[model samples]
Target: MSMTPIVLDARTLKALAHPLRVQVVGTLRRFGPSTATQLAERLGVSSAAVSYHVRQLAAAGLVVDVPERGNARERWWKAAHDVTVADTRTLDEDDPDALDAYLRSIATAITLRIQQVLGARSAMPPEWRSVTDLSDFRARLTPAQTEELTERLHAVAEEYVRQHPESEAGPDAEMVSFDLQVLPDLDVGDRS
Candidate 1:
């Protein structure tokens, strides 16, 4: 499978702006192919609502229909790509509103995933629990330094996973979420 990230354009940015659609695509990517009804049950949403959003995702080419996996009763769907990128330079200049919504939706979805893991942390195996992280650090750096930091972090993160996808994972392995955000806050400690 291709590892290229889907750079959001006007059409795709608008298509994935909704929170439900964002969650749908995320679910497909994380859990693999699934039917609308199955996704609805997993997400605690109505089947009709999930179906509607899935159709929209398919229309925007963010998802694809798995005809071979489907029978007469239900249709299967999977994410078209493993990643979706919102290039701040292009999107911030072009469609800021849609860009804001799409990014916020993603942030909300990520927060939910964090919460899910937190809730299940106590029941996790000792090995997994030992490696769990929910921490942050602060630093002062120039824009160029920040860019270099991000590139280096991505390189380190991609090292182990590049050759071993979830499909090729060993029996003792489990799918994990590894998120990286290098946001620059110009207005730190300014509430107003």
Candidate 2:
């Protein structure tokens, strides 16, 4: 699979500005491919509306058509990236309005995510009190090594995901959240 992050253009970002669209994308990212009917059910929206938004996402290249197991009527969609991001701070000099809108959309989506995760109930096993700790570490790395770092992180995430695939869960199980972000350790950089 290509590891390249999907660079969101202003129009594409605008397409994702709607809360429904963001939730649709998040659902696809978390659950793999899904049909509009399935997405509508999960998101508590009408299927027609979900279909319209899915088309918008497809037009923006934020989602792609996938092969279906059975009928031609089933439309499946998946997020273009494990994550979607602005990818750069350098705004297009020609379109500040679009850039501003895009930034707002990004911030709104992030804020929504934070709220969702914080409000969500944890699925701590009965022995939860005995089990977890949190911390952070700073590290230095070369630019070329960034891809390697991302892959290693994905591998670790996959290990945990494998142990608890969504299909294995009960209907009322609390969703476990995973957030991973990696950026250059700019503080240690040598400005030559």
Question: How many clashes in each candidate?
Answer: 0, 0
Q: What does the lDDT read for residue 75 in candidate 2?
A: 70
Error of 1 at 4 (Å): 4.7
After superposition, candidate 2 runs with Cα above 4 Å error:
92-94, 126-192
Q: What is the Cα-based lDDT of residue 39 in candidate 1?
A: 96
Each prediction's TM-score versus the true structure: 0.90, 0.58
Model 2 over residues 33-103: C-alpha lDDT tens digits? 89899999987899999999999989988888886543667877787876665644444564566766665
| Residue 21 lDDT, candidate 2, scale 0-100 | 83
Over 1-192, each residue of candidate 1 has an lDDT whose tens digit, in order, gives 348579889999999999899999999988899999999998889999999999999999999999999999999999999888778789989999989998898888889889999999999999999999977777878889999998899888787678667768889988777888788776788544
For model 2, the run of ten residues with the poorest summed lDDT: 126-135
Q: Pick the candidate with the highest TM-score.
A: 1
Output the lDDT of residue 174, model 2: 52
